[model samples]
Target: MTGLAIAFLILSITIVWGGLVASILFLRSRPEPAEYPPGGVDDHREDIGPAERDT
Candidate 1:
């Protein structure tokens, strides 16, 4: 095998392996779940008044 071919092969393998490892780590991580109470929408906009009608 030529030197250039060997070098290209090694570079490709390293890049592919690194990408696989990163994907696995990202998939393993978990995010916290959000909680919402009943009547959540009402609680959010209760203080805002209705829009005024145009003359």
Candidate 2:
């Protein structure tokens, strides 16, 4: 392949790989999922105000 084609292919692969890595890191940095007990209620976080609950 020509130099331009090879460069373009490499750049495309790099961009896609970078986006995947960024997505994984972003998701990993987020808070963990809520743990719900068998009672059917979620263990809410302190950040959630009382008004927000059961609404």
Candidate 3:
């Protein structure tokens, strides 16, 4: 029974550790703000200057 308890404890610890590592990796792999520039079709056009819109 002790062996089973130890094995379960190890598995729980491993799962928690794996979750933490995965979260860190995901955060690290996130794209920077510069990676995706602004101004898609749905973006606010009113904010742009009149000269820019004329171009």
- Candidate 3 C-alpha error for residue 49, in Å: 22
lDDT of 2 at 51: 55
- TM for every model, in the order presented, reads 0.50, 0.55, 0.53
How accurate locally is residue 53 in candidate 2, as Cα lDDT from 0 to 100? 46
lDDT-based ranking, best first? Answer: 1, 2, 3
- Number of the candidate with higher lDDT, 1 or 3: 1
Across 1-55, the per-residue lDDT of candidate 1 in tens digits comes to 9999999999999999999988888777844335557756546877777789998
The parts of candidate 2 lying over 4 Å away from their true place are: 31-55
- Give the Cα-based TM-score of candidate 1 against the true structure: 0.50
Off by over 4 Å in 3: 31-55
Error of 2 at 55 (Å): 29
Instruction: Supply every candidate's count of residue pairs whose N, Cα or C atoms clash at under 3 angstroms.
Output: 0, 0, 0
Predicted structure 2: clash tally: 0
Sort the predicted structures by TM-score, highest score first: 2, 3, 1
Model 1 residue 48 lDDT score: 75
lDDT of predicted model 1: 0.80
Candidates' lDDT values, in order? Answer: 0.80, 0.79, 0.78
**Candidate 1 segments whose C-alpha is farther than 4 A from its true place:** 31-55
Q: Candidate 3 — what's its lDDT?
A: 0.78
